[model samples]
Target: MRINVLQHTPNEGPGSILDWAEVHNHEVYTYHPYQFGHLPTADETDMLVILGGPMSPNDDIDWIKAERKLIKELLDNNTPIFGACYGAQQISKTLGYPVTKAPAKEVGWAPVHLQSHVIPGIPETLQALHWHEEMFEVPDGAELLFSSDAVKNQGFVLGHHVVGLQFHFEPKPNNVREMVVNDFNYIPGSILKQTKEDILATKVPEENRAVMFRILDYLSQ
Candidate 1:
């Protein structure tokens, strides 16, 4: 299988997803649209993984629009897509859902309760890394998979192949470090947020990685 990744920034690459793909001997390709405004065609990729970024899907950028177009085309063809944060917003936008700012930004570890078990392997309650201030409405016909206290639409599954998560389930420890270092401005000094040290101290990586593997395995099937 070939997995094509759409990366919006240099810092946010597929962490455990790439690792899983590599271990399973699946070919991987990446498109850094921020650096090169080009994207891979659906014919070239078996599955698509869209990673998070600092930018919002609502941003009126040329590349963002192009990526949305690509996402819509892929969904039309029933191509399996897994998205996180901004990537999830893009997917929601493509499906005619509204992506809006949350009442409060969630920036640390938070428990997301499972609303449905369509995705499988995810526990009823899981602490996922949160870093975004935006939340999207669940697309029509998509199963609302998860929800948190801060965000009502934490994740949703479209059919059996496409999933969009609002939190960072694919980030490793190093990925978190880079994100904190590079996007330091996002760290608000509020109760809902966390300090750099506190975030680095979490033991969510191993469990998050395992869950990510299960997600990929389901998508591949």
Candidate 2:
């Protein structure tokens, strides 16, 4: 299977998704439309994986707007997609639901309560990294999958194939460190948000990769 990634920034790669793809013998390709303006062709992408970024989906930037349009087209065609953080906001915006600033900016490891078994095997209340101030609204006819105490809409599934996750379950320890170093300036005083040192010190548990692979396995089928 060809699992293609829509990478919004240079620092945020596919991380554990790459590991899952490799383990399953799926071909992986990433398009850096933010830097190179290279977009993926639909013919080459069996599964579309959208990665997180600092930029909002509401940004008036040309590439960001173009990405939302592409997402709309692919979703209309019923393509399998998995979106994380900013990527999740893009998917929601493309689906006619607005992406708005959350009541709080969750910026560290927190518990996400599973609303349903939309993605089977994920723990009911699992620890996940939350790094977004903006949150996606659940689209019409979609199942509300997960929610954190800080963010009500942590994840959703529009159909059997379309999944949008507002949390970071794909980051490795190095990836987490890089992400923390990259966006360390913002200091929102939400109780749910944690300091850089604490976030960095917290281990990336095996369940993170396991849950990531479980989602990928379902998406690829």
Cα lDDT of all candidates, in order? 0.86, 0.86
lDDT of 2 by residue, 1-221 (tens): 88889998766878999998888898998898888987776766688999999899888899888887778778877888999999988999988889998988888888899998867788888899888888899999999989998678999887778889998899998998888888777646656657888888899887988988888787767
Candidate 1: residue 157 lDDT (0-100) = 87
Candidate 2 segments whose C-alpha is farther than 4 A from its true place? none
Residues 98-165, model 1: lDDT tens digits: 88987678887888889997777777888888888898889999989889886789898888789899
After aligning candidate 1 to the native by TM-score, how far in Å is the CA of 120 from where it should be?
2.3
What TM-score number comes out for model 2?
0.95
Question: How far is 105's C-alpha from truth in model 2 (Å)?
Answer: 0.6
**What is the Cα-based lDDT of residue 99 in candidate 2?**
91
Q: Against the hidden true structure, what lDDT does model 2 obtain?
A: 0.86
C-alpha-based local distance difference test score of model 1: 0.86
As for candidate 1, its clashing pairs are none
